[model samples]
Target: MATRFSSFVRCILYIYSFSTFLCLHAHEARETTESYHLHHTHTVQVSSLIPSSTCTASTKGPKREASLTVIHKYGPCFQSNKDQLLVLNHTELLLQDQSRVNSIHSMFSNNSDGNKLRESQATTISAKSGLPIGDGNYVVTVSLGTPKTNQTLAFDTGSDLTWAQCKPCAGQCYKQVDPIFDPSKSTSYTNISCPTPLCTQLTSTTGSPRQCSNSKCVYRVDYGDGSFTTGYFSKERLTIISDAVDNFIFGCGQDNEGLFNGIAGLLGLGRGQVSLVKQTAQKYSQFFSYCLPSTTSSTGYLTLGKDSEISSSLKFTPMLTLSQRQSFYGLNLTGISVGGQRLSIPTSVFSTAGTIIDSGTVITRLPPTAYNALRTTFRQMMRNYPMISSSDPLFDTCYDLSKSQSVSIPNISFFFGGGVSLDLNKVGILYVLGQTEACLAFAGNTDPRNITIFGNEQQKGLEVVYDVVGERIGFRPGGCS
Candidate 1:
């Protein structure tokens, strides 16, 4: 019942956000918004919003680009028969503003003691919230606890902490299709203490330390979409295929709530102390990559480490190294082009904050300046077609495809640092409405973070690699088979 209610509430919120726009388009079609949700099934990833001085030689992986000689691959996580329509949201926009506000408040609020770092005493618990955006999260298979209990989970690059539901749950556990993870049955499970450094790192706000529940370290996380996961910290062995990440720390969520329906929980890949990437940095070389399957029916893969020499043929884009906001993977984008001509938007518009390549977001999002420039150019090229107007922010360029025999969409490109140019697939540029209409697959972000995202839509059929250690991302076309 909780799960059903959570899903229902999400759609209501999405409609509310674009209620005016949706009402305007009410006459044209009933599935305009539903159709948009059909193609994209990804979610928003957030790194730890809390600041912690946990990095040391033992914690931070070597600053060298790791070799991808032996690939560890997993398929997309959200593979299921269930319907995936949800309120499409992102970064902060997808979830609650209160969480972001609380994060900011923590940053400026005085710290209670002298032990914590920065905010002098002002400490913002790094925000890591996954708002239910759509049905598409890149699902991966992993096992936790001893004698290994396998779990199907979502892999999020934008998140840093990994967690799962565990038992001794009694009344606290949400009903799931699979058996609840019984920690007592596992030989590897160990409780985390409240006074430990890791517990202190899990503070809810700026100065407040993580609390102790039943003498064990307790952690609480709330998302922007009014969902949260709460549990005690535990240490256990995590198995990805055959590799065993021992002493792995993850939350044993008891009071967990939100958009997650089929999966057990999440696999955090954010750039933070608790992220799986940092935990496996020593063995995996602090880098990993994934190729999302072009369509929902096919299988996609997530690979840890670098690709072989054949990957040298891929185009390269230099990553913007952000020291303060280390949780995000920032890319230096110049501008975009349509019909082989670059848009007139200035590069400064893209530089509003930091552009990160995210697999969680289904459609690509640009700042208003960058988006307006590309929209204008595309409109110019698409003047022959009839325009459809909507208040829904995601649908900017809609066309009456019913009147046209076939649409010869022009080439679209994303310009980035290191002279890298990404040519997008035609199908990825336009989303189809129920039967007669089609809309652009991109959106304009008005976020203060103004973070431009090259979402999964623009990344279809491509083998994209994130070389975090070297500060760059590599892209090669046509691999999502």
Candidate 2:
């Protein structure tokens, strides 16, 4: 099965006896919510997604762009029919909050420590429980383990770390990704001592249990949706299709549910603390690119060898490089237009200098102002159609289901760096109710699921290329190979 990178948002509705109720089109606040799982089918192929090329060096300049190339790298998903990778179904991560300091202290304090000291420390831990928002520091990913024979796994650019399930897990495990991390066999596997920086920070809010120090390098991670994954850490063998003799730092996860129990581990694409990309690039060259399809993104190319595919016209947007954090790619968005009509929104969406271009996130979320601009423009263009009263539950732009072709919304386009524009068509009409042509707006929200997601729906029919070497992204109008 494909890694379940996308997460599901549950829905709850409130019904009243009245035939027409004053409907409140409840919308979930848009934020960079974490993912639940990674889904990949065994049939996914890299060649189908990327253009093949021989590795070539770029012309060195003050700032030279690398040649874009896709190398031939294959893994189990390519050869087998069974789902071989375990993935986390959903992740619940929050910026550490000072209020959680007490909790952190209790979680980190050794019970063997004096009770009075532990209580005092608990107060301190709670105060520093959550990390500051947008800081992009102090994050973690707990994987299940490694490939027994040989397995190829996808590395996610939007993730924080890459790890797999380890053997000898205390709880449940998945069948895919051979040979779980048997902590007993791995000589390098060692628990994070309670006083160590990693252990102190990671388990501070949860209160470090004495059991963790007993010699196992085990860890636990909880997500926002209530699912959790636990496993041990170890120095395992990592093989890159590009090269085999060398190895990189990887993890072995275990005892995870949803999607977390299947695959060897994750390939974190997020910027920070020596990710898989960084580690791998160090061995070869600091260069890689991803060509994501405009259609269903069942496949894409991750190039580490060369940059031969570099388009001369590729727009280079200025990036705000964050220190001590995973540096992310940003866009200098100029404006968004619908059917050639420009909206009156600020360029801050593009100019904020930190608009994270993360694939890990399913939605292409814009700031409040950016969102309003798009909504207003869409509503204006859609004025020709009769507006439905908020009382209707079927659609925010409700029309009698009997009415044929009553609503028409134009295709919206987002123009970004380097003359690149991502144009989304009726797909932006993006959501419909259960096969019927009803707007998604009418979907009542009781539990605030992810409503503002600029899901794959927005990305359909647009070719996107993430150039890691150039530190920029490129786009082409048509579904160019």
Candidate 3:
């Protein structure tokens, strides 16, 4: 009798434990489904990309992939008649970068300043076009809405929120190639409520509070270039390659102002949820790669999902922590080598705090200490060449290229942390200003507050892979064109 009672009790306990375990499992799954269903989504965990959790298992038939043919900013899309025009273009672009740096300063600034601002003062905050100041060299045409409203947008790895001009503007809107996206015309459009986690993610920026208008989440973005876009946060089906992704959250900007003159919107490839990469993570496993053609006449492409080909070819280094300004990808740049001679600079000068790889900025900017070391070493190597003084702050290291003799630019290499080094030739290190002139594609960032940007110049013809799961970025030499 005693043995039977004990066995009965054990069985009951086992059953109870199993019931609780099932309940917990169901609850967790429900939460995940709810979060994903909302479409105003969260960032993808690298762990989630594993084979078991990938979209392949559940997706029937062949997997659908989207590709965008990227055009160069200065290429045929924005053709110029004069070489001087290209020179002036870089000057203006650099000024835009300065403004972008200021915006970063504001983003990482003491929240106490933001906290101190009266509720009214913090309200305002957020534009781009034909390879404009806020844009990168590559551009893509993105289609959003049910009937597939196509808009040409600049691709930016530094920007977070993906926004576009929408119809029924209360204040201001830009002149885009296509008419504004009418959310009402789309069957899949829906406004996000303030109570949802998506709203919290959108408003998490300092001083960018949660503002609900007519029971919808309203967002205002202030970009690095002082461009501002204010609109409602909503979800809609974004069509690409005849395939559509439903419930993609984006900004419906009614008042978007700034350098965005001819384009429709921005395709934010930043490391944030509001970006295109993150939005498509569940379907694509948050893996995306791009190859930028060296020149404007060539074509490059952006691919979604894992690429076994690119991965095998890349050599990678761990990405630094999100110490500040979460959008930028921080990496430890230990030192630089000019003509095979490493610059004797302190490691602290390459602190991960103020270093990033940006897709938009054309020229690289390093801390004054690091820049001077690189410049001094480079100039020493090129003592034979005639130096051309420049009054423009943008082109500091100009050289007279009018001479028939080509400057034998020594091989320059950048050393980053974790045994990773990037070797750049003259083409990658210098931006030729017409046939008569050329300049070192680097700037002295005297302001300690600003971070060093690994700009497009350094990234030319390299297949840079952002491996979020591994927390590393890989680079490989390739003919992108």
Candidate 4:
């Protein structure tokens, strides 16, 4: 009787243990399945031209995968000339991929967790277009000489400085844009004196600064867009709104017609002695803003001052300084997410600390894998919208003009230094449109030139503040408009 009782008790204990083991296994399986579903939803299949390494999890700059061949067919100043000449020369440059520049993973994992705002009397400005012209930030009209010369010309930030195609040019010169800077004749034009602060930092991708023994101030600048501007950095009257500030100038290259206009020069923005922002910030508090209008609008505003309209929700983030040779702000990335789903991209994408917060571009470009992952989620969210197609070269995706669907996409956010987060509407984060059926255009194609790019379209309705003195920036969703 005793043996039978002991055996019965053992059997009961064994059954209880088995039941608990099964429950534990079932719970683990459910957790894993949920995780897999979340990851797969955000993965996109991108063109294989871009490398997989570009999407790694480091804060390094992006790598250029291929060369871009841009043949300028028409520009506003020279479109009527009908010249097929390659005015803007395209070169292969190493650019920082935007994806790798900001990592979402690190943003959440790091210490201090980016929650504090630096105590400073912060100023704000609207972002502007750095191309075509100043976008109204610093409108500098150039001529052969001082006010007496009156050879009025336009100023462009896309170009490095203000310069005309010079006479007896030493390099390639296209015939369509004809007005050239005459170094020999402009009486007011004198060589930027050597040993001056500007001369030490003068440089470009071409070679060392030409000895300024003559009257022409000379320097060189390589652009993020693969265009190189060679010119002199000199003192000129720069009109920033109402103030006539003496600023360093860029006398651009004759070959620049490949990418530049017949305009007298470029407006420097690099950290060198001749940069427009560098020179002007000395007196104006180093605060500026550009209000880029919607793609449908024809005009915008570029204001310089402490703009107080920046969202109170904004947190100032740290800025990473790149090599002196390069321009544009750089930042470290942690990772990115859609809805709440995290992506499983490689860590190489954000390894280099070389991403730019540029206002000139129209869309955000990323590594093949990273771009695919985000794009996949974006397409899914936008799938319900009606499709429309147009011949407009500017349109990237097709959408139905009449189909009005309430936007239901989630807000996309970016995590950067100082615990700052930048959020945007779901549709605003993508470069897709549903204008028509069967006609799909990828407006912002990921090029080999830049691994990642954050363009103007993503900046719509956002207030971007540049506090140069503070070495920090604050971005607010929606515009100062």
TM-score of every candidate: 0.71, 0.54, 0.75, 0.56
Among all windows of 10 consecutive residues in model 1, the one with the lowest summed lDDT is: 114-123
CA lDDT, every model vs. true structure: 0.60, 0.39, 0.65, 0.43
Alpha carbon deviation, residue 272, candidate 2 (Å): 1.4
Candidate achieving the largest TM-score = 3
Residue 439 local lDDT, model 3: 75
**At residue 432, what lDDT does model 2 achieve?**
35
Better of 1 and 3 by TM-score: 3
lDDT of 4 by residue, 195-232 (tens): 56556545332234464645544665444334445555
lDDT of 1 by residue, 1-481 (tens): 9999999999898888798777777945767545533332221111111112222111111122331111111122233332332222333232322233233223222323311111111122243333322222556677888888877666666555577888776336654535678899999989988777767666442122357877788877655445567788789999877778899988888877766656677777766667787678788776776666554334456666654453566787765534344455667888888877778877767664557666666667777777888888888877877888743445778877665555656578888888998877554777654355667778776652445667776776577777656667788766543
- Model 1 segments beyond 4 Å from truth? 1-136, 170-172, 175-177, 202-209, 307-310, 390-393, 403-405, 447-449
Instruction: Score candidate 4 by lDDT.
Output: 0.43
Q: What lDDT score goes with residue 190 in model 4?
A: 52
- Candidate 3 vs candidate 4: the TM-score winner is 3
> lDDT for model 1, on a 0 to 1 scale?
0.60
**Candidate 4, after superposition: displacement of residue 282 in Å?**
1.6
lDDT of 3 by residue, 1-481 (tens): 9999999999999999999999999999999766543432212222221112111111111132676666565555433212323323656766776676555545544533221111111111111111123544567777888778887777887776677888887779876556788888988898889767767667664125557877788887666666777888889888767658888878888888887766677877766656776667777766666666555455566666674555465777777544334555677778888776788988777663347777777778888888898888878766766788864567778776565343466567888767988775334676665555667788877665456778777776666777654567777766362
Relative to the unseen true structure, what is the C-alpha lDDT of residue 90 in candidate 3, on a scale of 0 to 100? 55
Task: Write down the RMSD of all candidates, one decimal each.
Answer: 19.2, 19.5, 22.9, 14.1
Give me the candidate number with maximum lDDT: 3
